[model samples]
Target chain A: MSVHVAPLKTYIYVFLALMFFTVLTVGVAFVNFAHHAPKGIGNVLNDAVAMSIALTKAVLVVAFFMHVKGSTKITPVVIWGTLIFMVILFVFTGADYLTRPMTTFVPVMSQ
Target chain B: MSENSTLAHHFDSYAQQKESASLGMWVFISQEIMFFGGLFLAYTIYRWRFPEAFAYSSNELDIGLGLFNTIVLIGSSLTMALAVRNAALGEKNGTVRNLILTMLLGSVFLVVKGFEYAHKWQHHLIPGPNFQFSGPDPVHAQLFFVLYFSMTGLHALHMIVGLGILAWLTAQAAKGRFTPENHNYVEGVGLYWHFVDIIWIFLFPLLYLFGRHHLT
Candidate 1:
């Protein structure tokens, strides 16, 4: 009985939990991180915090709804193949986007 | 005389057919995730360069609607899962009922999303010539809305496809084509539905509601 099939009902709880965290993360973001920062570090801190929670919610979805948790060897192997392929794609595309300079005309600069 | 040879003649048992179906569906899902990964990475890079623009623009999105859609999608995912379970357990009527519910919920998601997009379009919140964003970085703001439209619009397309599949599956269920012994088709579609929900889970917060509170 190690299959440990995920039940449909449990997803309700997961959904609620993600909601709670999303709201909480958003709420925390509005607390004026500058007040807690040295000078201009507040925005960075706030972004970091918000991203952390966002990442957590993403992980929850991957693990649960996708049912990747407690998966077998073959399933993980297939997933790894997909992950590796996606990584290659991301790296190449990112290289292109990164190398290209922002060439759009800036209104203020043009003025 | 036992002619349920929707199974390939080479395959001996229905279990193999079911397993293959599951594996194939998973591969499809992996491809989908990778497709979305492109946009996710784009979002990441843009946010990295224009953190302030991204943060400020997010403030304009309706977080409450975003939250509502998230819950609705999750609820539909649950129904999709139940549909699969019912199919796998040889409950034809239950499977059809659940698939119907799932499809209905999907339609609702599209309706809500349509309203949101129309709102943006009407207000010229979209990011082209005549776009109206007073943010410090209009380009960055436009980038967010671009990502927003591309991502959610693609997701909405998937939901439409998923709804079509569910309708067909419901028809098959009504005909008693599915049995507890062979319902991988239902399970496979269920996986797709769940994947769609999972995407929304990230998107609800990321594309729409993220960083909104920070600006407030």
Candidate 2:
């Protein structure tokens, strides 16, 4: 197999992009979308935005820096499989927690 | 069948050996993702349960330090990538220089983290019998600190280990151990370094920037 040595320019470009996203995330954090949106939705939106940017950065690093973009077929398979399981873990656990009655487990300190 | 000295007898060619090494590293990284995933899950649940407490506690974190460290870590990732590039091109000095620079940035991150932890310690936020918080929901706020310390503490530990790897890589590169055809070790370590950076990419926002908008 021929080694695919990525150009230096590619690494620099990805680095710049990661830095830009980092600043954008910090900027987004200071904006209170809650004041503009319905009661609970604002915080959710904030989290969504922050996480989306983080995901973008992660993708950039994984693809270019980690060379997964040019890697063998099994690499993405392993990554996506792990990610799917992670989602399952989150969704099933979240289902239980989010649906539970608030009073079911009150903080002992509050009592 | 392989002519390259670095090629293992068990592998058919250098390429096959390199692919196997890369695959093994990814598998290890997959397990690491799950390991950290559990903490992220706990964080999400607790933050959902105690939004205000978590926000207030998050606000107590110094964003300046967090942002600085984010840049530092990302910068280290860039240097690590460059180190791999140089190693792949069989540039010995370039590889060593970039690896050393990566280690330097990583150490700076740890130093900043040390100061942050010291700040927490001084402010009585270490989350123990002596822990104290003036917030309305000190209990829940303490929970936030518990996650904060554990998550970032674990990340710091990874950085220390990464630095150790970089040190060894630097020494090896200095000795001209890696060549264009046999730099899989450099590439593998670079992947680990970038993975750690990705973890911090998520950690910075979740831990330091969570409730900044609420801080009036």
lDDT tens digits by residue: candidate 1, B36-128: 998888887787777778877888788777877776787787677777767766778889898899888888889999999999998788867
Model 2 segments beyond 4 Å from truth?
A38-40, A101-111, B1-4
Candidate 2 lDDT over A26-102, as tens digits, reads 99899988888988687688899999999999999999999999888999999999999999999999999889765
Q: Give the least accurate 10-residue stretch of model 2 chain B, judged by summed lDDT.
A: B1-10
Clashing pairs in 2: none
DockQ, all models: 0.35, 0.66
Q: Point out the worst 10-residue segment of candidate 1 chain A by lDDT.
A: A102-111
Strongest candidate by lDDT: 2
For this target, which candidate reaches the highest DockQ against the unseen true structure? 2
Q: Supply candidate 1's per-residue lDDT for B213.
A: 55
Give candidate 1's TM-score.
0.84
User: Which pairs clash inside model 1?
Assistant: none
Give candidate 1 misplaced runs (Cα > 4 Å): A1-71, A89-111
Taken over the whole model, the C-alpha lDDT of each candidate is 0.76, 0.91
Q: Model 1 residue A93 lDDT?
A: 77
